[model samples]
Target: MKTNNNGKKSFVQRSLDWIEKVGNKLPHPVVIFIILSIITILVSEWVYRAGVSVEFFDAKANETTTINAISLFNSEGLYYIFQSAVSNFTGFAPMGTVLVTMLGVGVAEWSGLIGSALTKLILKVPNSLLTMVIVFAGIISNIASDAGYVVVVPLGAIMFAGARRHPIAGLAAAFAGVSGGFSANLMFGPTDALLSGITNVALNSSGNPYEVSINGNWYFLIVSTFVLTIVGTLITEKVVEPHLGAYHGDFNEHEASELSLKEEKGLKNAGIALLLSLVVAFLLMNPWFGPFQTIDPETGQKTLQPFMNSGLLFMVFLLFAVPGYVFGKTTGKIKDSNDFVESMIEAMRSMAGFIVMAFFASQLIAYFSHSNLGIILASKGADFLQNQNISGIPLILAFIIFSAFINLFIGSASAKWAILAPIFVPMFIAINLSPEMTQMAYRVADSSTNIISPLMNYFAMILVFMQRYDKKSGIGTLISTMLPYSIAFLIFWSVLLIIWYALNIPLGPGAPVQVSMIQPLIGLM
Candidate 1:
């Protein structure tokens, strides 16, 4: 029997040990993706043979659409397998974002700009407040796709090491906010646009005049940003850090050192370049004569929608590349344009393994989507809830739970909502619930489990980050370290949600809990 007695392993430790041993025994991530791809191919054929199909509302087409499992085990499937190989790798969205972002980030990192910044941050921010700030920054970082995992998570470790704290704990905190707190953010992003569009399609299919705004959950998310920051900090300090004990690794001592005169000069120039770049970006986006500016057809006012939509990615690349180049030149780390190019190449070298993993993962994801199994399972879950006689808070709670369960399997928030929204949005409308609330609930579920799900696109990248700090760190270690933050965030975030529901607060501008039940009461009133 396991006990807490001296020399006897406690139950939790034993459990973690078992998990680590078992997980480490599993296949490598690339091999695992290959295996899942095979499984998806075989299952598609089986399900198709079994005649499994689903009929659901098509919000986009404004009609009922039927889905059936398409067998990837057939001759046609073999052709697709061969034909789409390169396109699947190239078209995989996350793969492109990471690869491109790394080109600039790698240069910045290799130029010693990122390291010097971490040292400055360590000196400025209080150690007591460091974890909270990192976690908060992580949540905010999601505005730039993949920035949190690819940037903040590693920076957290470096900053923590500079502060003489446990680097793993710092990594855990950043991961918690970037992923586990993904549902909570102060601003709208691609996720907001994607999910809202899906939600609106569902609402359109329901024939409801009510439309969910992209900022529908804005206020709640604003609160969540702060709430999650506190909760994440508390969990990291109280649970994750104590469990990690102390970091005893041979870390880069230069990370904590005071920057030399040249280094400080480089940082200063980099900062100015970054700020000036932002000002130029604002002018290009906001001025009436600016190329990116557009006049609203209805309001006849200039808007930056074009820039916000199309320019953000380029902006992210410049944000890193421009400052990095200036810093490199200032510090003489980059003697020529070739030195700059070499730094970028070095960054790509680090990502060599991840790029391989992305290739296999793309194939697996493409196969899964082509097979229609993900949507089928999601629909089956929605159908189960619809058949239940549940309503009000209980139904909402049940949906939350089910969506969270669905999240364990499906990693894309937009994909999950595309299936869920068509069913739940209208059904909730008939019962006095708003589409905004439905969308909000789905967001909560979508984000709560991201850290623990191996299928999360960035999970492999984060695991690589973990190994850099702790050679013994495995999938199990990353999961276990993050599991507490996930649980705590799920619990408290849900509680905050419940409290918000009970108070009948406005979810955002013109978004309410009951949606006024206007359509239902129209004739009667």
Candidate 2:
């Protein structure tokens, strides 16, 4: 047993070493972009010829299958890539959505609005609820998209460290709730609204129309908030904390700075200013009394069609901008409008790598979607699962495992979902399984495996950050430390889902607990 344990440790160490060495040696993300594009194109051809066809429920459109390679070489295929690339770079992908939203966030981040706000927010929480506070806040931060990943995740580790506890445990707990908990937010984020929009478009293309509310997954996702928090906190305190010894790093003073009086004043003023702004904006848009009301008197529906779809981005801007400007002027970072604009532009500059990745990711998704790969795979897989007559409990568990496995190769949650959703959403919907449930399962798998995946773009950024504390810490150290959280999160979260299913709890408002009980669907068996 000792020899086997030693062998396993050695293997893990070697694997980490290889990942660090090779991961850094690779060309820029742009090169990976080109490679991924080529691979996506190849996969499209392979999947198409393999007899994959997207089955639409629309009687008029029936099912659609495009010749993957033939379409690509065709003029239309070439035109689509060129057209899409411009949009991809210009914020057509999640990056675009995130970037435009960050203009407001940039102000908040630059003016220390986020830091001060976070401090004020968490400092008030009681010790007993610290873990849940961190976890829940991390989950909710998804409303600002990557702000949860960038700001809240590291702050979780720092916050835990300040609590005189295992910092790694804090990082793990936070990472679990933030990244692992990505899909299960209580509020609809820009991505949620955006993806739902895309899903609607995809369905509409097949002659079946779906409302943008196709994002009804939020009802279920919100409940997952409590589920993940409990699981994350338990895994942190019980499993992860005991594994790491005492804090021995030189920088382990473990003190979190207190907010100053000026910062406090700024926060107070910012809140008041923001509240007033919201009231004014609402009054302006109200057809009953506001200045810019555009409601149709007959239908009572607002004629402003773009507002619902684009509202989240606007919210993001307001959420960030108000606090940012308030903090900036008070903190003396913004004496003029130029400073504010610069902050936004600077934030855009920071996303250079993400933009590059988005370029290829966008193309890959477009090609795959056009080729009908996602639909084909989802239909066939869903069909097979239905044929097996597997119990729902086991099926959910297996689905989690499959997603985790796939996550190793594909790191971007949105990108992976773009490919998977078209197929899984409809397929699951057909099986009487809610798309929300499948989305929840996919998030668990995607998030748990994120830290361990060499392909995760942020893995490199994390390695660099880890090196700041321990020069000896490499890929292996990071992965080894994080792998436990990954395993625990998957196990605990999966069990929670099972219990929820058994109890017949609503996953969300208007979301069903069971896909079907009386009559099993045709392919679902």
Candidate 3:
């Protein structure tokens, strides 16, 4: 972090510059994953020979489960390593979501649908407020999973480029909100449901016999959405945008030019198609007799709802693809069926780099999982905190930092929580802290570092997005740019939680910071 001759940059600035420089010098992303896979294999063998293992309460099954490290260096492990290669790539969650969603997004971008909309949007939106809006949109997009990373992040760059500002700055703003603000939303979505179900199990395992409701952390998350949006906007407009300076990339450079009659007609037609698509999607998800609708059977209520499953994925495809095709046809960007198909092909071509990276990334992630490294490490880390004998705000801060640190290696929130929850949830309850508060701390920590974690599910996808704006941009460039937002969010989010607790506010409806306040509803059982 050396200062330049003028020394105008602060230490933080110099540090970020150093990080970017050092990070980009590392191996190419694909090669990095390959190296990581090798490292994982060797580490697993070492831990296995050392007889390392972890045993924690398996809250779901109501028993203790032991996890022993299985060496990828072993014969059986090697077989699994070779056997699941193709399936690993295909099973990577973001792979199909990106490819399928892009089928329409590709058409939208190339067909001038997305471009025209962005142009008009840029002209209408005050430049000062653009960052806030993009950040807000990213936070809100969480309610519809996976859409933000693929759709919103790129569009942020396009809009900023069209506004004659730095494109990467806009992309950072969106990425910060989408990934870093992941757990914060105005409405409780599937993440809430999944985490609460685990929380309930953990609570019951602690002998509380309570029902940790899905809305347990609702109040905090709602406030967090606005807090993060503001924090992201500030980081983008003040820090990231200024640091990046100006955009010299090969942007379209379209002015605030009036739309041609053909463009206007295309927009109108596209709007109709979009509206119709939504109408049909609604009908298909209607609870009465919808084909995709299914009762949980256990709860006797709709469980696998459209937004709750892959139904939303297909809906995203139709939403963009139908409108893009109609717009392309109306504007002569698409001449016929072949032209429509070609748009999709062209989109796939742009994704070539991402697709290749996904292959090695998939193997690396799978190997790490198969080795039992993530769960064991998460357990050991939680055990450390539990033995510390600390309490109150200091203990809270330690837990938040621990959760954030663990999140770097283990990207999946649920996976990490499944191990940590059974430990922390009960431990916190023993100290008079509610399970909801513990869950809130975990969620805050989980999200704060996602933008900077290479192991994050969509990190490679975002790298591909970055390269579109800066061909030479590498992992270092991405991390350096995003580091500011991560730091700001971690600080702001944790402070907000602390202040809320100090004010004696409930985390959610009937979910207090004190365990004693929570009624053990399951005593009825």
CA lDDT of each prediction against the hidden true structure: 0.82, 0.61, 0.87
lDDT per residue as tens, model 2, 1-525:
112344443454344445545654655545654776676666765654565554433212223333223345446656776777665445433554556666777788778776677666557766567778787877777665555655566567666766655565566567667666776676766656555655554444433333336455666667677777777777666545554446666434444468898888888878887887788677766657654546657457654334434554666577679878987898787889999889888877766545555555555555555555544554455456545666456777777787787677655566556555555555555545655566667767777787676456445444444544455555555666677667877887777777777786766666665564222323311
Model 1: residues >4 Å from true position, as ranges?
1-14, 294-310, 519-525
Flag the better candidate by lDDT, 1 or 3: 3
**lDDT of model 1 at position 205:** 62
Candidate 3 C-alpha lDDT tens digits along 159-233: 888888888888999999999999999999888988898888777776677678889999999999999999999
Local accuracy of candidate 1 as per-residue lDDT tens digits, 332-411: 99999899999999988878777787888788878888888887888888898988998988988899889988887777
Angstrom error of the Cα, residue 504, model 2: value is: 4.6
> Which TM-score value belongs to model 2?
0.67
Q: Can you rank all candidates by TM-score, best first?
A: 3, 1, 2
List the lowest-lDDT window of 10 residues for candidate 1: 516-525
Most accurate candidate by TM-score: 3
How high is each candidate's TM-score? 0.91, 0.67, 0.95
lDDT order of candidates, top first: 3, 1, 2
